[model samples]
Target: MSFTCSDCGKGFTRSSSLQRHQSVHTGERPFTCSVCGKGFTRSSHLQAHQSIHTGQKPFTCSYCGKGFTGSTDLLAHQSVHTGEKPFSCSDCGKGFSRSFSLQRHQRVHTGERPFTCSMCGKGFTRSGSLQTHLRFHTGEWPFTCSDCGKRFTRSSDLLAHQLVHTGKMLFSCSDCGKGFTRSFSLQRHQSVHTGEKPFTCSVCGKGFARSSHLQTHQSVHTGGKLFTRSDCGKGFTGSTDLLTHKRVHTGETV
Candidate 1:
């Protein structure tokens, strides 16, 4: 594919560079690796692949003293230490660990269901995220807790639940010393420090950690009557809450 350079009308020799230059026309990842079956858009990435096999960590961060195989990875890691989130969600003020994560999250706002589940009508922005969600309906427990032997569908969920037992707060906010098990929890906790209630109630000004929480809060303002047990007069926000609350009365723990 011979093409004229937009800069000086000079013709480029290689077709691959021409395609990458025209990723301006359509974003494409043509270059692929045989070993890991990973795809890349450029030859430089294929060369970078050698570092993973060679176990060569060339980049070192001064702040956190972390090593990375690539300088780009090191730079991205440094962003975590600096708390510099350049990319943000347009729909919500929620921040992300990386720009790619922010981009993936934007799909949630746009309702762009690109990654559809093969098993069901469900769709997601990222493939791995969809894979994680599928485990819930499938009743598949791949990760089990060592302490209590309680199984979890997703690795992150298992990790978070393990914290309940171990009390391991890995993610902590610098502004406030409040620590959380997961990065997401720490992020939500930071909102408390900043007094930034990003997600507000549509019916009321009440803010919550999640949209579901906001919905539950709205139900209260709407004066929506929640169902109570026939035998018990105990109140609950929803059926799920009522079911869980019933467990307490029944002396059941899962």
Candidate 2:
């Protein structure tokens, strides 16, 4: 006999399944994972949660040979190779492989920042992003590069930094055929060919391809002397000014 949940109107083959489904509405989680103290509505969900502690990934992708703890995770990973976006954003029409990813991306259009830092009033779109941002306040550099002994708060940052030590330029510009270690660097280089000056100076309205160039241009307006002559004790705005000033001592008027 089939059992049906009155609250959700969902049919289940077993009475146990119906009982488990009712727990969702009742806000009851009888089964709990001992490792992480995570509550689950059913024993099967608790069993699946235990795999996280055991590091057991039974599901393997046939396309890329990647392993996942669950079939749901494996199916999501397979979408990358197939280019199948099952989930889409209603606001921006952008597609994502996972529903959770689509939910996170939708926050961009909604301007909803659910995650916030406790130390500061700063907010982030994702909880993971907020955790990473907290490292700046905590001064926590947990992820370390084995090659260069350099440390970063996020593992992704360390992985990107490792590419610099390897000297491997995977991303290349099609216009100039110039290569870059990162895709962002390639995108910035491509802007040069497109003549897309995104960064603009507020003082003089001078446009620059890179933000660093705009920052250097802003130094001209700051009236702060960065370079100082050791011999004459005179201050200059830039290194070039210091070099030009040094010629007075050497008597080289070239």
Best by TM-score: 1
| lDDT score of residue 68 within candidate 1 | 75
Number of clashes found in candidate 1: 1
In model 2, the clashing pairs are none
The superposed Cα distance between candidate 1 and the true structure at residue 82, in angstroms, equals 4.0
lDDT per residue (tens digit) for residues 1-254 in model 2: 98998875879999987886676455577887675455666677678667856868899999978788778788887886899998988875768889978977776556466666675444566655666766655657776789968778765577678888888877788887888776667877887788988667778989888643654576789865555666777876544566688679988665
User: lDDT score of model 2?
Assistant: 0.71
- Per-residue CA lDDT of model 1 for 11-55, tens digit only, reads 677875665666423334576666544445576776676565466
Give all TM-scores, in the order shown: 0.50, 0.48
lDDT of each: 0.65, 0.71
lDDT of 1 at 251: 93
Q: List the residue pairs that clash in candidate 1.
A: 22-25
How high is the lDDT of residue 85 in model 2? 93
